[model samples]
Target chain A: MNRPKKIKPWWGILPVAIFLAFWEAAARLNLMPGHLFLPPFSVVMQESYHLIASGVLIENFLSSLARVVIGFCSGAIAGLIIGGLMGWKEVLNKAFSPMISLLYPIPALGWLPLLMLWIGINEALPIAIIFICCFFPICYNTAAGIKSVDRNLIQAARTLGAADFRIMITIVLPLALPAVFTGLRLEAGMAWKVVIAAEMVAIPTGIGALLMRAESLIRVDIILVCLMVLSFMCFFFERFFLYLEDKLTGQWNQHAGY
Target chain B: MPAIELRNIRNYACHGVNLEVFSGELMVLLGPNGAGKTTLLNIIAGLAGYDGSVLFDGAPVDGVSPQKRRVGYLFQDLALFPHFAVASNIAYSLKANRWSGEKIEARVGELLDLMRINHLVSRYPHQLSGGERQRVALARALSLSPAILLLDEPLSSLDLHTSKYLRIELKQLQQRLDITTLHVTHDLGEAEEMADRIAIIHEGRIEQVGRPQEVFFYPANEKVAAFIGAPNILQCDKTRALGHGLVEVTCGGLPIVVPYDGDSIRKIALFPRDIYVSLHKPPGPKVNRFKGVISRIKDLSESIRLVVHAGNNQLLAEMPRHTFESMGLVAGQEIFLILKLAKIKVCEGGLCEQGDSK
Candidate 1:
């Protein structure tokens, strides 16, 4: 019975259209001052088609996406388990909170050189880096989400004959879902960023490597093409997460801020 | 229906509290704030650690966990699951107890109909009005058909009209269900309204447990007398026997005749609503009548409260707004006040022992 609201699609794309038109005009007029480095929008589009036809773009895009998915899923699952335990049991929280606090402040990329030495510059290296990036935010947010559950709700559950495990599953977890989704959305974006950086430094495949290759050859259009692909992928993941969050926890969104 | 008995129950907030709530009775635990009324309820529900035994229908449930004890608790905040719709909230216990899907659905539908919230089954807690939310909470508490119901100030947060309405509804529901209930509230009006038997608790101990009229008119001690809104407590200066089950006591330069008891009287307690005020003195026995001038007037919405200065005493008297208007009363006006002789509660040695006065 519910219908989606109508939206004017052009309103979303107007800014991109204006920027593209300006770039094409600048390049057509031969506007100097690093004009060679700044490729025209049309040139980037043409290069994109070439890369796609040759299967290079698809190959790198899939490889990067695979690493992000594997890393993000593994990190998110581990975060959920550890965070749930910590949040539920005070002893576990006390034992692990200090260590988590100590390590969380270090940037994900800060672990790269050591991870490259340990993981040896392969697919595992980028995946591990992305995993590190995804872990902390998800873990911290999950623990906080569980901790913030109303005590009265737990008491109400107890008086209703709900066992401890049932209370956790039915009351605590569902109440914490909105915060968990917040953590997931945050780490999803971080996973993409970390995977690209890791692929550039420690792996030979993916969009990041394609950018590195274009940089060495001074092929600015190829660099522009890689940037566009990364931008689209980031946008796609963000929208996907937002859609998932809304679908799963839309009823609680108004109260999630509490 | 199970009779709940707490024997010498000791906890962090409450100590050495002994009380019994009879089967199928709504016993209101009336107290001021920090009086451990909620702690006693928690002890009965097995949610709090206590030093003494809690018995249900004369069987000890000391070691029972809260979930297995079958106590339905309606928290002061109601604590309806914000994430669940009304149907889900009511079905929570049934689902927890592993009731079949069909049974859960049937019971939820039955409760929705009972609480008169069938149309709200699909709505979330935040989407409902205050009264609707309260009904949902009550329905959820009664979902498992719990043996004993513990309500902690359930109607304290409601508007006056809604609170009054729900008090009647709750009392009727409790009677129809025939469930033993321990209802805690700091509001005297609520306790008087909903209680079958009222237990006045102060400083973690039960001062008195009796019928509502007995506890109101004949408080067991000074603390219960003070907490139950006896606004005219005066220190007795002297007392003399009047020879026919009556004694004359001078309190703050005002001589009042009260029921005679053997123990020495030190103070006298009078409820504001029991005092009669009039513009002109009518034909009466004049046992405890005195001429007084109204010092201050307060409008209490339904009634008018006057501070009457009689001799060296300041007494609070309340009457219906219509009565006050008909008398054409104002501040500084002289009036004759009659303190009902039998209703004047006399305290002996700072404590009013039970059955000391009629």
Candidate 2:
């Protein structure tokens, strides 16, 4: 049952509201010439409405969302398969762990220049960038999850007449789910950042592309609108992933006990 | 014929194990920690590799896969599948053996009723209490009606009352099912309570195997005597052979006779229950009589344990609380003792390390 009396989050919202109000006031009063750089809240809202009405904002948002979603999914699938194998089999681990560790530290966006050169500013560029960013965490977490399955459970399953493959499917995979989810969440965040970076570098239609174009045109309001839209998208996805994690882990924890 | 047999099963630094358990008997593999009892069970379950052969009903199963080995293992932790509900966990082994859906359902239903866990069919392991989890695990292991049941300290983790109750339940169930069961535990009390035959394992070797009363009274070696709960072991420095499986020995300057084939036994063990304590002397001073002062008294709830000091030797004597109260026993009081010479266990000749005392 849900608790009836809840602590209002108005206190948490106060600081952000105050900051935005201060910005709006400064822009409206034109405190200084540089006030142009900080547009009023009304101006930002008008710019957002115009973009939405013209369909630019929705199209660009959809474009960025698609890239991130597709890239993240492909990368996560690959990571789970590869990492599960690496953790399950010693030979695969010995072969791939070193390479993963070596490559993990390098930011996925760092490959943008080389990728752009090879793939030439197409949709592939951002997708590849996002995929690169998502892969490492997903792989690492999944491997750690698989490795974390208790040895006793496996032995028990074997004695219960489960073959090696059945043991892996029934015991190993389920036990590793928590860790796999952890990897997916981390990769999703990284994927969003990579998509933005790649789009800013060279995308025909995306929020990141709009932000760059607005930067060139010196349209501070449109830039701020684009920034806010991107942030809202990221926040929404983060909450969605968190809810998914909570539901799955909550079910798992009930089964696993303490 | 034996239900399960381990012949020269040596692996993982365990000593050579040659043991057998007959059909329809609850065999308790008793030992202290690091005794390789679990390893022996693992070897029989085909979970651990061993050099020698394991036979079930006189058939060699050395090459059988663990999946094909019809031995149900109940681990110390139970190892129930946490993600599955009680019914599914029980049905898991059956499904693995390729049982059809309807058969699995029927089998799970049967096990649920048998284990009295039908009410918990849909409950996850975490949702159940310790005893419930234990029963569910047993149901899962028994789903396949295994050739032999291997219980690896299944009752060790429960509370005292639960362990005691479960011990009786396990015994009755084993009898009803007539399943050859090999239960491993370091708890001597449990072994005494449940084992139809007690296999005394030590350092990976089965030192002795016999009925509960036999192993308790007539341990074949010093290791078995020490491991069993013999509170009084006397040093026999000089021994002379007597006729026909008897030995006369001088223990702590007192001569006593013991039943044995040789004169090489350097020590003899006496249970506290075998010794009688009295305020006045009424018998002859022979192999069974001694004079000692009560050094310490331990209240054991149901019974009292009294340690007697006799000529640089500490002898333990146990009696009912009613007897202790009736005799007005107290520490530092001098008393006469009788050890019942016929009950003296002439331990097999070897250096036997004493297991944990009490």
Candidate 3:
């Protein structure tokens, strides 16, 4: 008797429920040892609560979060400046864009050994690695943003008597903000990923370190806890990014969304 | 004193073009597509690079940049900043000129009032309709108080109805502002409506410049005559002078007396409206009448345009719609043309022979 919408909200929740139920049934039925496989969603939820209550878990979580934020912020700032310069001047774009591409393809984790050799086992190693990982996306996006501004807007500014720097400040920056935000979204996620990798080897302090420790002790439950924490961080940041993106790009969508 | 003088100005697209625009005059630059009308405007505004000098109030302007030249330009597309509100767009010029905050606000407010868009000041450029956006663009240009305003086909993109309305507003605003202007358009109607003087540019060269009446009445050559709406250009061999601004020419093996005051090989131009049509050849010595068979009869409001094949020449005449109806005029119908000599302009050579070719 009810008119069903094309896409029902509750329909999306079905797949997650099925996945958890399958895992729980398999573990409880002893398809695999409960200790080795960690018995599914209920067990993981219980472990999450226990981990949160422990001060060590809270400390590691905060440390990882802090690393991501600091690295992403620094990297994004550098990206903005470099990208703006590259976009504005053809000479600069030629000079620096190739250098960026050269460094971009090398994996972020590839520098972990070099960073450790330089900064040693400290937070700097992880933060620096995260910063490096976030840099390329942010920088390239910013440059593209500036270049992509409608040429008519620039012409209008010139006719209004705007000088060079003023044009860049008032017209170019605002127009490029959407692209910068896009870069930020991508870079922020990269920074979080970098933090995990750095924490595992160089610093040994956060979720990645916890996963490594659990693996050495042959405790799959704790390892699953570390992964759950990482997944939660990615999910939380992605949501926050989407919120910001929606606020900025929703109106612009009508004009140039495609 | 001239408000703006372009001396031997040569640039890409447009060659050396010399022009002088007096203060407070609305000068319309008329041209066909790719005649370099826009290039001339851009060179004056410093938007494009060019050779030679553009003097604003007797000072050389080539050394000055676009912002420093103080010339306001409205591109064909009306390049209004899409990101800024209308008020902000107008105020941008003032801000760039380093006016104080209160001064900028007062100037912007006055322009918004002048442009009749005080209600839409907060709205962005994209939000404005075609006509509203045009007014905003004009207001933005005027805010700078430039030496001369360059309007590049300001109404070209609008619908026919919108263009007509904007043309009236633009003409009124130009007079009210008392700013020297260089307006460019390919439309003869627009030139007739807005120009104090018309300059017809063709192929990067100014083909002719004079008062609209002078250009329309006495076009220098065939090209200028055709461009200014001279519908009938009859190729005739002049046989003898009929005396007192009249000449007898053998057109299509038929000798037709035309009003020709000039000497040598003549290309006779006649306005379709000047040529009257009659059902029967009316008897009058005062009127020059010739019988012809109507080949094409186009019904236009107020008047009927008739293309008549008289002997070897195709003669076009216009009469009131009722006259054609009363006469029962149709295609293949025979009619007589009452030719008026005063309305006919005779040019000796072509468009290129005269006007600045070098």
TM-score top scorer? 1
User: Docking quality tier of candidate 2?
Assistant: acceptable
Per-residue CA lDDT of model 2 for A1-258, tens digit only, reads: 877898787988999999888888888998749836878898999989999999999999999999999988988888889999998998999999999999999989888889889989888888888888888889999999999988888988998889999999988998888778767766777677778777887786798898899999999999999878777777777667777766765654643222
Per-candidate iRMSD: 1.0, 1.2, 2.1
After best superposition, candidate 2 residue B77: deviation in angstroms?
1.0
Per-residue lDDT tens digits of candidate 1, residues A1-258?
A: 989988898988999889889999888777847736777888889999999999999999999999999999999999998888888888999999999999999999999999878878787888888788888888888999999999889988998999999999999998888888889887887788888888787789999999999999999999989987887777788777778877766785674332
In terms of lDDT, the poorest run of 10 residues in model 2 chain A is A249-258
Better of 1 and 3 by DockQ: 1
Native contacts conserved, per model: 0.83, 0.70, 0.55
Q: After superposition, how far is residue B7 of candidate 1 from its true place, in Å?
A: 1.1
Q: Score candidate 2 by TM-score against the native.
A: 0.79
User: What's the CA RMSD for each of the models?
Assistant: 8.2, 9.2, 9.0
- Model with the higher lDDT, candidate 1 or 3: 1
lDDT, residue A3, candidate 1: 96
Cα displacement (angstroms), candidate 1, residue B32, comes to 1.1
TM-score of chain B of each: 0.71, 0.70, 0.70
Model 3 Cα lDDT, one tens digit per residue, B185-300: 98776897799999988888787889986677667777786566455766668568879877777666667676766555445666677788778768868446778899998775
DockQ of each: 0.56, 0.47, 0.34
Query: What DockQ number belongs to candidate 2?
Result: 0.47
- Find the candidate with the highest lDDT and give its number: 1
Report how closely model 3 matches the true complex, as a DockQ value. 0.34
Residue B243's C-alpha lDDT in candidate 3? 90
